[model samples]
Target: MNETRQPAHHRGRGPGRLIALVLALFVMLGLSGGTAFAAPDDAEKPPRAVWVPDSAKDLVAAMQPSWNLGNTLDAIPDEGSWGNGQTTKATFEKVAADGFRSVRIPVTWSDHQSATAPYTIDATYMARVKQIVDWALDSGLYVVLNVHHDSWMWVEKITSDHDNVMARFNSTWSQISTTFRDAPRTLVFEGINEPSFANATEAQKFQYLRELQTSFHRLVRTSGGMNANRLLSLTTPAGAPEPAFMNDLYTTIAGLNDSQLVAQVHFYSWYPFSVNVAGGTLYDAVAQKHLDDTFANIRTTFVARGIPVYIGEYGLLDYPNHFHPSRVERGEALKYYEHLNHTARATGVTTALWDPFSYLNRETLQWRDQALFDWIKSSWTTRSGTASFDKVFVPKSAPVTAKSLTLNLNGTSFRGVWQGGTKLVAGRDYTVSGTRLAFTANALTRLVGNRAYGVNATLQARFNSGLPWNIDIVTNDAPVLSNATGTSTAFAVPTQYRGNNLATMHATYADGTNAGPTDWTPYQEFNKAFSPDYASGAITLTPDFLASLREGVTATLVFHFYSGQTVTYKVTKSGTAVTGTLA
Candidate 1:
């Protein structure tokens, strides 16, 4: 979910070229003391080969099911300026109480530091970050403090500016290292988040990432105090999980001779399910295979070589306004979390969910989707190796009012139902058929007609029941559109009305011509597109759309929520533009 695309201007010669330039600059400057390029003191060095702590494996094991405080501290320009609410002490407490053992605090220091010489971070900003880190540590959570979203430093192509950028980068870390010099080992440092090499070839990008990591390792190690042997994390080239990228990273790291390193990579496999809404199901064979291949590669490339790996950020986009309309999307999102966490445990990788208040409400301290929260918790608690549930779809025109849906058990013996929600009835409304469940006629009718219906059942194992397992047989319903309003230059659909694919939307002119359901491309093709905010529940037409409207023309925008359910809002552009509520 933390896909930070490089800005267009950053593209140029790769890091290999920049390194040549950097070396030349170093020679020209002839200044060697206290810089990132400076060699470490031979006396302070641990050994020729880096000495990895015995606790490294234990640390990885403890950091299972980690959660990220994303989009909050890491917001560009300022914290909480982004849509996410300001993080409080209670935020970390809530996460830990809910069974998360680790937290990745992503913070951007670019705006908080001086752009000129020394590049000292503002004292107030540093203190605030320290307070948050202290809170996390106090809450008994492992904390990863990282240089996040520092696009100003990393996004630019290394050239004549390479020395200046590296100087600033080294200065920023020097300050950070000094500030947290005495902090406990639980406070891990991540060098960078999703470093981009916009101008580099694959080979160059890999080399550039290695250079960055090498510099980061050297700076942190030489910073003194606990940082000398701190458990540092580094990103793969572009933060990708590809075997080739990771293999290159592994090779580069081995040469670094540092054993106390954690390889951090982000996972958002299968874009159709992870980002777009066109995927069939989350637990389909294709999706599983993708995950399997990804983790397998990671395990083989990094984990097997005695290096710990962390999935610094991994999650599906489940914004209520955009992705929550389709039950398929919601179900798949939950399954993705479950499978990802389970796979993390199976392989020696720690997973951290990217929670920018998309699935959880930081303000109210409530889960936006309890089912997903429970599934994630169960995956961590039960450690169920392979868990899955049947996706129940009852047609509105079923012949019988009541029907029994069977749960498909994959060789594991079903123990018994642990918990069921209010939507399900144990005896009168439904009955169990071995591992299968039978819903009465009344229950079936309710599921068919209702907009939301589902029951979660926790099943036990006969033996070696890894974790208490739960499966949801959820009913799919047509998307609902409501509270739509519009104006001359803009039209608004309430967040609840929008669903996954805005591409399914079309505009019909009064003259019987139509436009879009536009393809997602350069983002400039269509002036008007749906932009929904899940937190605020506001869907408004962008200003670009209003400026592009033809004068003296009336058009009706039709949005297809599902196959048969379509909502339309009409707008007329006269001397002034006006609109009507969606119908």
Candidate 2:
């Protein structure tokens, strides 16, 4: 998901420096392979398709449970520059076998095209894109291809640089339409991804989008072959799901008078819950209501009007960083995914996960967490019961006691909790009363043998239907923090977690106003501002967070843990140096 402008913290040069270093190495080693493809005389007009095309609604419905090939062709300079590996035919095979019916391949053409009048896309890059699309098509998966990051990179300049933008846009699509003129109808053409405009009023933004989309429709229709009837998708400004954007997009498609057009929108849930900031640490009523209302509006605005809607991208904003602590709690995230899939089905919109090698391991072609993936996949067909929290945190220094958690049930009847193969005795080991599940002290003591500082045991809460909910038995203590000294660019608080997991961090000035990069909320974004490294026995304050601190002003930091413990500390940034002390 490319934003019009990245946040200051996200705009750091770490990735750019790495890309340059890697590209230089590739050149020095003479490993930059050939990109040229031998084109046949009739390459622009290949064999015609015999299969009849389905209506836009039917085609969109058939694309349920889709996936996105993100951060590949869309990667700024080249493929594999971002975390994900190069695209492979086996990747598509894996996607198909894993039950994804469609794939959205986002392509950024800026770096691969010329800056002159013709603005010809590099022949080699074009061929590579075609190869990947053909591979996905061979796997029997519907393909949605679009101009991706270029939307913000240069397309957004349409308002400021109209003629050049329009010329380049037309040339880019003309070449693309000609390249895939005879491709299968399964290969969809999306005009642009998350369209945006700079220095434009509401009227101008709407007018610009209508012009771009209409021009796209005209170019594709006149390009001949399957292009004449191919399914096309158009997104609102920034691909937001708000009503104004959706209404404008509807107006654009209706003006085109094309039944093969689908409305596209991207959803990352409510802002705070998406990134786990501003005290939105749970999937509460506000978050759930937002999902319900958004999907309901999409259905009413588009689907009911005979235009199918495609939730082009849907996932939490700060989801599943494989190398860092998850911003959102695992159980809470599970509930969000489960509810989202069910709601998507209820509203008749096809949804696609924005996977940039986070959900699936590109190197291993295996799910990073099979159990979590099971809940997501299962949610496509049925509901899953979840709990208020996944972990039962027990203080290692205190005597074991009864602990209770509220069960969501989610329309399922809760059966008893089980430890591996054996089912615990209901009344003695645990008790369930009207959505409340409590574990006896004896059961907890047995589970947390030796009071290990981490997860000691895992139990499954079974339900009459859907996947079982997992409960982790954890033994923990209030984390210990020590004073440290370092520069603002590099600083980590020495911490002894003992067992508890970090939840959120609160920052404030002496006058009680919020501090850090996001001053609007005292609760800074997890991973963005601070991250917990349990193995390293410390919590690292990100350079972005440290730099955002007000100079010569002491900011009090209150670290909150999942065990309901808060550790207070103070930090003062002076020049390039920073000092930390226990408060």
Candidate 3:
């Protein structure tokens, strides 16, 4: 063989039995006399479980709240590389504030190569990467560490031919897996970047995945790094991880079982304005539902197996970068978020908005987009509603009017509210396409544990009769205000606090269901805080901070504070179908 293959002593080291099957099968299969012995067939194999990732899903979500970070990282220098360490720290804070819980730092050590095969990554780069990671890890988020563009070796022809590509892929990951052997647990690693196998046959791709899957496991185990059994995330060819096109990848991928790598899928699905169709964007029911249905089942598929997930890359076109009609692009993004939020919750896989800074139009941050800083700081909150409705709501504004929608609480059957124009029903299901209001019939009552387990947290699980819910919350004509610095001129929570204010109140009900006010508080508590900050324009607080002050078992509290004369309710979640208020 013209290509030099590394020695075999560097294989996996663990108590698990070596695969007698793999070896026996290979031997029985009979190798051609000319077959290369040094580079075994398992060269490009990924680990047993390629679910764990070395990128921060949290940081990626945070940085480009409106764009995808992994793709973005491919284009620019990381924050610390351009300025003092403070810039990197500040960037982390901004990302965390944006609700990101991890970051994937792409390292191309080859850039730092100093005329050598065992290229050394610069200490400066490592320090900078570490600085941002420390911020993310400290902020209670996940982090991903991987060798990135530097894996270009896998891109060129294997020995300028077919055989060598296999050899290099394994050698590269082996070296990579070894290099980060001592990184922290939170830092996951990825094996490759978006790779293209243009010349490889479909059969070869199948064989390649299986071989790479097995080898990835071996390399991580051998690198003797934290990567062993660590969460790893793999990518689909060219970042197009559509299930329909890559279903076989899953069938073959299931064989490697290290239990760390989570299932991963990328998406950029479009219609009407892409490929064959020539028209305005399709942010309508067709596009939204397609995305909803596709991802919903994918999550269900992985959840059954107990694997976690990450959206490695996904977003609308980023400015000068064209996907379609520039006019309707923002709306295109809004529909995407709605579907992602509603569908991804059960899988515990949120989103990492893709925005390669220089690649996007900054103004994409219009309206109530959580993707932009101003929107997040201003009106992009978890909720908004009427002040009048704020003071105790009991099924007032609209009535249930859909067909067959179910209302369940805990584990019992109860009547849910539905509305068509203005009517309510008790035992029927109503479906409203535009705007409908609903309240779950039963609230999750606090749980009681076995006497053996004293002082346990309340059990808050909902075991409904497995029915579908289809009700839309009315968007109040009057703007909803939860804090002083609201984006719109109309809706702003007045704040007047002398140190004591709850930010959120988790309220459960008699029927084993739940609902909470984004800024819940006792009337007086609300007044005390709201009076001063009414004119200031912002209020922020943590859920635990709210839990600290309690009035009674069934009361709601808002955990909020005034800093520099401004109330900050930094974190929030919103619902599109909230009724007046829970009884």
Candidate 4:
């Protein structure tokens, strides 16, 4: 992620000399414990003082579903330097048309500034940035402009060049705040992007980062214009979303007592799903837990405390990797985006997608992943149905074999159909009336045990609009023991099982008496009786399950996999040990 490069024009200088020169320049500019700037005359007052929203919640609410003009203006030295094309007025128009409420423009001013004292930002670069900002505002989109990826100055050890770094940071913001001082409330200023501290303890890093943010807050507030009331954003050290990092930031910045401030954090939860294509499952229990835990912490730690948080960057990148045969599955990507945005809205944390010309095709003004794009756009306007199976168990020999499924439509009525594979066989195997799906007894009996079965459907209301409304009614036939050993039982099924799969165990004695269909207590559940190896996509009975076995007893373990596929494995105990084979 490093893009550091010194200006070719500057000659070699010792580190000590450079530090002294930067410090001397800072003193000259009155930044070293002196008056930072001269008071502006009455004639220079801002034309109009925009009333910045006083509530952080309101500010975050207004910036929902934001986008980043990443790898563009934030590129070093010049726009388009990083392979991303130049920005245009039409790009902002498309972003608004695509349903983004706000835009974040990341600008790296280091390469565009004079390296010596009182580092001045280049006029041309400043004009270009202003142009983009104006375009977004004109298109009725909230805009956030921030210093980004200026690694040369802040990425080094703070102990070595703390003063020089401070000088550059203060001078840069003084210029930026002054330039946009008269801008409307729609324009927000972010202090920095992902500040890094080298060779420092967590405590030291927190203190230093807080000092930097303090400088930012002070500069923007006292820059002599409408900036005093403008909304300002500050990020924690490293821009991490961990609870500890957020708590530290909250503790440090709460001292400022500024209600107009918005807390910023970046989230890329579950790297295998978000970035690389390895070592993580999508939309599963584990992934959901991470999301829930992170957001819940932020909500309790910040949002509930009246501090609005914004996800400055979040979204999976479309990169090729060996684990996934292709780019992220469209359905999985849609689920990811929908869940994240939905949770954010519920938690009062605004979200912005980080795009580098992957999902959104900027050149053609179309989304490369249209399904993902549509899901995001429609979620803000549409109502959908939730489907679940009441009973996933399918007994191969019993006449009482029907799966009762229900779909609640939130009181909206719609025409529906049941589909399986490539055929539309609603009346053949199942019937869908209103929100109820009733599978035929014969169809349920024919379901292959130890395998996955799915009933797919779609619903379209007369008044509804947007992406196709569909659901997958999936359940497993009772798991049959696929293999057995002296002390172990194994069942094979699809790997997409939910947490509720293994909740019971039953035993049928050789004397025609039933021992139990024991309810696996949540605290001591059968799911906990086995260990899963995701890489192998299988679960093996643990010694805990083995300990429960008794000679001359046949046991059945019931569980469910993805789409409600239930499995029932039969095991025979011999000599105080259990052995099993597919039934």
Candidate 5:
């Protein structure tokens, strides 16, 4: 399905919805007399009954690959307020067509409902939610709808406001159950997204979850219609995949004795690698083990006990942080996704991508990176060969020499390398020894002809099976940085990358102590303390980094590059101003 293309067209636009808009406007403008007005009680049509009752295991299996509609309905205050486009049937249609079997619509209801007794959710918002769910169901995709941001918003207040919190939680689920009471079983209801209670101790955290999830279970069961047996998912505190949190969820599901229940958890890989801190720039052993162990534990804890687990959300923590540079490298991210999906399939765990238009563009309905998506889609059923890095850097100032890259066969055999339609000769142009793939100097010289400052050629390493690995031939030298003077809040050093890419930055004071906000590690987090603007030929030292420095102290900044080069520079903080000197 990812291979096909279709012309974009709007579909299933809700008719006569301007009245709902008028109601919302009145509420926003304080014209509703301080009480939110409910929409007309128009009898809603029931969804077409196409789902047959199935075991929780079977249901989760059918949801092999799922996608989340993140930052949209889940956005605080209101939908589309977080930069995502309005929800439409075409969104789900594209998802279903592109190989995602299910969709997770995270809805935040804090601002949409009343704060007092009955906790009345505005009828207009409820109907809009139903419209989106029905459209996904009609597109033949399973829908996992959940109480989204309300988790931290109000649900977490249970520690301080227990009575009122439970009241609102019960009322919210009661309305949700009644609305989808007759919908097909494909519509799964998740109680809460990442539930956590403030000021609660370890014992209280577990106790609070049991009470909250039990209430949700009871409310959905008594709502009648198909709701009596609808597949319900319960989550631990923060939806953490840790053993303690998962064990709590398992105990709760077992205590309920309902075969239609699912254990939900969210994973963002390892913290250091996830946020690209502490020199975790690569998906190394620690990061891979975190992913493997977490998934393996999920299998042993839930799947082994005849209980299904749904990884409600999984992705890098800083994935598609549109405002900053990528924390993880492109090839490294591909490896993470491939390993995650393959591991999920192996352990019978269902995973849903936590997408906030990070992978697919909501506006155009196209993948932001088709090749990256291809590796992900391929891993759903098979393995793809990858390498240590995606780029083959050749120094432009020197003669082209042979370059070797370690291959991550990923259980696949390497065939050869291809440049456009021409395949390089196995022995003459390139050679493979064990996992090492080396490009001969002759091959490098020919490929990097008239070497530019950026990528000069692209090569694809074809494997015996699955998708091919991409290798970019880039030309560059050690990046150059110039002295600069500016205030602590706005210091930008003139830089000329010369085609080389920054990997990490080390900051240390004259006394040899670590510098910057992250004092524990000399290597500062990418895009946090500092960021490189390759196109603009400037390196910006963020205010947070500068603010952490001591006045009159000179900190030596070492810029590490993926090309195995480092540029040293020194900066001294003088009260509110700072000066950078090229070392």
Candidate 6:
């Protein structure tokens, strides 16, 4: 670990840094001066600051469903919403109607931040954001406020000593954190957007990220915000949650200062694999498997180690070019989304669909094409029927299980048990013959109409390790797991930055045994490569974004690795498998 390990004491912790330093001090002084790295005792589960229901559940239970927000609940809209602007409420309603518990509003803060470098959002603009917040809360949905596109701004300034960016970022949050200061525990505040540009090392980028996150906590606490225990969401270099991204997040903020934080990833892929663009054909199960495995691989790399992951943005293609489902697209996407939904549930990850208005093209707000609405519809069942007359929204007698989240099932007038049968257990069939039931946790879900929430027991486990041996460098060699003689070095992969599966860079001896570093052998990373996304002058492209398009025509790419191996292929039929590195 050439990375200098200086006394384990973080310098300049920003806001949360001081808290972390104090906690560290307590460990050094209180633990009999043992000098062992220490962490603060977990306080009694603090008040939750974010909980929300899906919009689908809301449609079934809205007081006034007349006003519809467009594809993005991000309209710099006017009244009837938050920013003095209109909203994408119709979209949010979809979230509420489903059995979701929260609404993640990805705001492009640049709209407000574009001004004199150090941005200041006016009352009119903020009112629009708050109005939407009110809508979600009023609908009993947990509201999550996060800066989305502005990650670009921070990146632009980070290198050139752009102090204004930092100032604006902090100042913006000061007011925001303070305004929602009295908000219920259901409201959440994420530090930044999908923070990164085309080129930024994972380590360096995350260092800045830590500074930003620590700032959020500092401002919130110092500002005496209401949602103090706010559930914070951390950013990866990009939306990819690869090992490098995860490690950076962990090292930078994990022990910095304690706050409710969740790791987040955006599930956007370009293969027969990514659900982002839904029209691709998955004719080859192997190709489909390869695609799906990508996400599974990512989830396991981070989540398996005990960090909760939230798939903040995932959706089948329902936009400009890919909106309409064809004979090919529908057949593929219909089952694809179902499988995606099932997979998400099985793993207990939370999901929020992108562009609610675009779920089924805006012209026809009703889901006119595709089977997303159907799949979601099947998973939910009405929980009640009575209006204000009933006084009680849902029956207190109803059962809520880890497998099933409460929802307004089907188009039923009243709420009823929507059997949590989406993901059948490994050996069990999701059948109803005599009443025995089976289910798996949905990767994606939300809470029902507004209700106070209790936090889930965090399923987390960290892997601390000892040093090992090193092995020979296999240049241009595709790792073959079948061999029992070569090394399977652990190269910590990069998340959204580029697509190399990151792992701990470890080396084993030629004898297929654990031969870690000892001066005899050294460790290294076998950097994977995909075709260049683009290049102009002295610049080169990386494999972070798999599918690249130019002039509306998507081209093929070959991924080359720093390890000297390269995989080449082209795009045919959304996800048709082409030849490349899988040699």
TM-score of 2: 0.89
Residues 310-427, model 4: lDDT tens digits: 8999876543122333334334555566567767867878888888666666678777767556677655444444344223444333444566666545334544443333433567
| Residue lDDT tens for model 2, 318-342 | 5888877899988889999999999
| Top TM-score hit | 5
Ordered list by lDDT, greatest first: 2, 5, 1, 4, 6, 3
* Top-lDDT candidate index: 2
**What does the lDDT come to for candidate 6?**
0.42
* Model 5 TM-score, all chains together: 0.91
Model 6: per-residue Cα lDDT over 1-583, one tens digit each: 2222121122122343454455457566764222211222223211111212122122212111112233343443323343223455454445444344456776665555446644667777677778777666544455568776566755446655557666877887887886778775556677776777445566567667777777876787676645555566776767765657766776655575553566667664443323221212232355456447756765665456555556666654333223221212332343344445556655545665665454444433356444445444332221111110100111112343223112111122221122232322333312222222222223112322222222212111111221110111111123221101111221112112121211112223334432222223222211211111112111111222222212223233233332333442232213322122111
Root-mean-square deviation of each candidate, in angstroms?
Answer: 12.9, 11.5, 20.4, 15.1, 9.0, 22.2
Instruction: State the C-alpha lDDT per candidate.
Output: 0.63, 0.86, 0.38, 0.63, 0.85, 0.42
Off by over 4 Å in 1: 1-53, 83-87, 152-155, 278-283, 318-328, 363-370, 383-583
The 10-residue segment of model 4 with minimum total lDDT is 1-10
Per-residue lDDT tens digits of candidate 1, residues 1-583?
1112111011112233453455447557964321111111223221111111246665666666689988888987777787776678778768866767679999999889988788889999999999888777655567899998885355445534677777877788888999988776767999888887666788877866777778888888998988987788988765779888888888877898876788889997665555443323345678778998999999898888888999998876443332434323454455566677778777878889888767668888788777667767766644443334333444332353565445434334545443343334477666766655656767555444453433322232221443444434344344445554455556666645322223234566666555333323212121134454445555566655554556757667665532235567665555545454545
Q: Which stretches of candidate 6 lie over 4 Å from their true place?
A: 1-85, 88-94, 153-155, 257-259, 270-280, 286-305, 317-328, 360-365, 377-583
lDDT of 2: 0.86
Deviating ranges (above 4 Å) for candidate 3: 1-73, 76-87, 108-110, 113-132, 149-172, 244-246, 271-277, 319-327, 346-348, 358-583
Q: Least lDDT summed over 10 consecutive residues: which range in candidate 2?
A: 4-13
Q: Candidate 1: minimum summed lDDT over ten consecutive residues — where? A: 1-10
